[model samples]
Target chain A: MNNADHPTQSPGNVAGIRRQVVLPLGKSIEIAYNSIRVRFFRSLITTLSLVLAVSFLSFVNVSTDVANGLLATGQPELRQALVRAGYDLAPEDRRADSSSKQRWIVLLSLLVCAVGIVNAQLMAVTERFREIGTMKCLGALDRFVMRLFLLEAGMQGLVGAAAGALGGALFALLNGFILFGGQAVRLVPANELLLSLLWATAAGCLLSLIGVAYPAWVAARMQPVEAMRVEQ
Target chain B: MTTNKNIVRVTNVTKTFQLGKIAVHALKGVELEIPTGQYVSIMGPSGSGKSTLFNMIGGLDKPTTGKVYIDEVDVSQLDAYELAWLRCRKIGYIFQTFNIIQVMTALENVTLPMTFAGMRNDEAIEKAMGLLDLVGLGDRFQHKPFELSGGQQQRVAIARALANDPAIILADEPTGNLDLKTGEEIINLLQNLSHERDVTVISATHDIKMLNVSDLVVWIRDGRIDKIESRDELTISVGRIDARNA
Candidate 1:
């Protein structure tokens, strides 16, 4: 056969011979997609749980702060005084409703995310014992194996974080528009959305690492023979 | 590739395993030496510690006592990463189950060890193809492990084991899973490798038919060498010799 027909038969044939034949194109995306596909429903449930939990805690924190501030200022003499002092006794009806809902939503989302990460990592590790072994046998050190899991989890985290942040902000904005009828009810921190995204990603990784620890340990110590013996 | 005369040296090696409360002795004071480019087969019954011996020699397990030296370097003292590196650079391994990664194509499986050895992706892939071609699986590069038959898969495993151009190929029951014809083909291929590549082959097997093809036969019993035989000591041709003559 002609050399042209054999793509792997290049001038650097010897060098080409040594690489792990990773499939070119769509590998990273495919890996990410598959990881998400395996954990999507569970991750949603987790994210929702966490969102609710965090939101509730945040509301508690904010309300407690607002209440203390109002108390410190004593009772406001005028209706506008409370608003000016950042302690509207009546507050806009829509703002009150949304702020209340945000508590539960944030808590729910956080719980959902944490649980989903644990589940996904556990499943991924369980399913790929042989693959891990093969990598080890091929001379992969502990750090390399850990890196693979980290990368996979990191990708999943990015996806989940982006989606949660966007969805959450939209929900918050929708609540504001409906309640205020296009009027302002204090400032909405746009930067918090970015912060939330970053936080979600970091949390996703942290939770996944916790889940992956045992499996990664097992893999790191796995004898090449045991890995080879595992049934597909 | 060190041009070392003594490739593998084993001295007073002992291995034991704790299975619950009982301690199972796998190898006891085993001392052996394998020179470079030797083709040897280890034969034994099940539970005879032949597998354990192979594992130790392949650097997959550390002996409880004594030391293993490959290319005159003591392997027992090396750290995990260094030991892994030694396995990657110095030894090739073939398993009875083929042990080809299911998620990877044949070429990928073959090239995987080189990747761990720090070879670039392109170089490893190209070399993997060449090795596959050498093992007569050139056209099946993209075939996943499950897609191939037992014989085909074993060929892929052989290719994988040879990927790093290691001096020694450690095969544990290489043809134990194949039928008579396929097993013979594998044996022939291994024999050809011994002759052509001058690679040191250490295989553990129960296949009586393989004796004819082996340069040296080591019978292991209770983790000890019962008898060591060179090809000149054998008298009988067990099978197919008369047929071929006819």
Candidate 2:
């Protein structure tokens, strides 16, 4: 280590003028994982909101795909069975189309999910105010603190979204079996269901990042907020 | 270079905090200097600018109207990056709450700052182990903060504060939460550590026990230094000096 500390009380001389390196992303991810595990219940609650919204979307998608596939089969026996099951085959194009009402519901549900995430994260960060202050006092840069929060949120989002998508897809399958018997399983293509889940999961993860953005920024830029607390 | 003896200097420092519509003067042109390798205690009643003064010295918050210098570097001049380096390498903070991360084990908590300073994991672990040993918590390295007693947790916090070998250790009422015996032990540990490491120890404390181990006691009243007394001066003013006070 160089004797880089100049001791002349110069105006611009920074103390301990040595190279500073940030802790790697891997270390932060590890810490974030540990924190989530320790606060498992809290994290579970945050993940639940994400799960509900993503599942709703995937359910709508998979159910539509199954209904479309059954309709597109076009065989008179299957069509007659579909009519018996209350299927409206007229004007139902090859492309699966959910009504505008369902689209509004999806948009509303996702917006609610995002708002829930932001609220939960903000409260969580507030509860960890002292922890954040301690880390800052220990020389954690703003970027490091931001990274920790984002990583934690991202992990929760990923887990919750995948679970929701799978659950919704499975539910759609069971509903299909009950409504149309063996024909339901044979008609619905698996690839469409898979595609719906992939995008649903990605959207959930992106929402998580956007949700955590403000709280993480608030956590990072503080100067050990407790510094001004009265000493008694 | 400034005198090697003085590690911290404060000149005409004032801090005004705006609560709502009015400005609260937290520090009122307070000036003081702490010598290297000395254990100094700052004492005051609540709302007397004790914490504000401490913040200025620690460089956790900048002064509103003056300057604070640590190791001859003007605190007000450094940007955030430079300021972080100063905090990381030049100053160690011990809080009253023993604010060790609750999720991390004692060893991990101690190693955190070192890793932040860019020490490799293996080396950080080795150094952290040595620090825990020094603080007498080597056997409890795997214990989380919740698992440790108040004193033991404080000891871990001490090890953490020393992780980067800071030139100054700022203890904010470190003994405020401990029982008398544990508090005394902590104070003695701090006193000895400062002497051995030749680092300045600055504590904002209410515990009179601190007066025994401290070489100097600074009393703040109403946003200004009321008096500063050497240990010898304090001893004579009260009664005959104790054997340890000598």
lDDT of 2 by residue, A55-96 (tens): 888888887788777877766676666567655556554445
- The best candidate by DockQ is 2
lDDT per residue for candidate 1 within B1-246, as digits (tens), equals 454476788899999999999999989888888867778888889888888888888888889999988777676766664666666767887878777877667887887777666567789889999989998999999887778999999999889888877878888788889999999999899889977888999998888777888878888899798888778774354334445667
Q: Residue-wise lDDT of candidate 1 within A37-98, one digit each (tens)?
A: 55577545534433443343333333333333323433334334435534434643223222
lDDT for each residue of candidate 2 in B1-246, tens digit (9 for 90 to 100) = 233468899999999999899999998889898988889999999899998898889988899998888887888887777777777778899988898899999999999999888889999999999999999998999998999999999999999999999999999999989999999999999999999988789999888788888888899999999999988888764455355467
Residue B67, candidate 1: C-alpha displacement in angstroms: 2.4
Q: Give the chain B TM-score achieved by candidate 1.
A: 0.91
DockQ values, each candidate = 0.20, 0.54
Q: Identify the runs in model 1 with alpha carbons over 4 angstroms from their true place.
A: A1-116, A171-198, A228-232, B1-4, B235-246
lDDT measured at residue A62 in model 1 versus the true structure, 0 to 100? 36
Across all models, the iRMS values in order are 8.6, 3.0
Clashing pairs in 2: none
